[model samples]
Target: MDLIIIAQAVGLFTVTNIDDIVVLALFFAQGAGERGTTAKIVAGQYLGFTAILAATLAATFGAGFLPEAVRAYFGLLPLLLGLRAAWKMWRGDDDDDAPGSNNGPALLTVATVTFANGGDNIGIYVPVFITVDHTGLAVYTAVFLLLVGVLCAVGRFLATRAPIARALSRWGHVLLPAVLIVLGIVILIEGGAFAL
Candidate 1:
């Protein structure tokens, strides 16, 4: 491992995922005190990041020709999810959709949000992925996954704190759906996914 290149990759990945720390914390807070909460959030993070790596690898390699329109359409996953959450909330049906509930955004919803959030990551990771050869990419991916675990641990720790956990517990329901909706719309517009 060239120390300098590894350092650069670490720096770039950390900078790109800075927001994820907060996002992950919020997710942890969502299921705070619930059994297996941390596990679910970590699983979702891994799932989402895997999708990102796949997309980056695909784009960096010969499979880089996906149309912008089609890419934007990817926003649909998160958008529909957010809408469903809002609908459930509005209908007072959120009991079944609560964080620990079967209908709530679980591993897959979190993965969608992570993937949708990672649209910009492709732009960043593609160049990095291309610049690095197979070996370097593999090493970077390994480090990235390890760092993701660390990130989730930190997020879970912070979420377990009394103050933050309470606030998130009170407001997470009101905020999560709205956040997902706006996040999806931003992804759509940013990616130029709209037909217009």
Candidate 2:
């Protein structure tokens, strides 16, 4: 259990940040305006996360999957996705739908964004699971879910403040993708795909 908690904490902490903020923005823009909406979104996020983690664990233990080269390739996924998002933002494309807008805050939307945003995390966890015990995977998943909910609540509270939210929204667009790129690079280096 302790191992699980540690893995969950590490994985959750690794991915929880501006990336999540962008995802949350999608939900908020979609009209998740009710007071209870954030909680529901968080719950939905966890469901998606758990599903991904389960799959990752299965692949790790059952198939001995995720070779180092494969991990490096997966590490680049976030870089590509983040760069695409940044390009869209730079091009002033606002046509992207918020999660709650079309589906009315359905669990599916939450799952979608969770899976999407969790792509890099999944890549990271592949290696983690290769080394860590299966129980650690569960702990990592639970802790990540708990922390994400808290972070979303806090972010919602902050975004409700007009000026701060606007400032965060502006900077978040620029910073989030940059951070993801850096994380991808780091992972690649760790996987020995990059020299420095």
Per-model TM against the reference: 0.87, 0.56
lDDT of 2 at 193: 70
**Clash pairs for candidate 2:** 4-136, 4-139, 8-140
> In order, what lDDT does every prediction score?
0.75, 0.58
Error of 2 at 26 (Å): 4.1
Worst 10 residues of 2 by lDDT: 95-104
- Residue range with the least summed lDDT across 10 consecutive positions in model 1: 96-105
Which stretches of candidate 2 lie above 4 Å from their native place? 1-8, 15-18, 64-105, 164-196
Q: Could you tell me which residue pairs clash in candidate 1?
A: none
How far off is residue 13 in model 2, in Å?
2.8
Best by lDDT: 1
Tell me the lDDT of model 1 at 55. Answer: 81
Q: For residues 4-92, could you state the per-residue lDDT of candidate 2 as single tens digits?
A: 56755765565544566655654543433455566667777777777667657767776654544555554475566556656766776
Candidate 1: count of backbone clashes, pairs at least 3 residues apart or interchain: 0
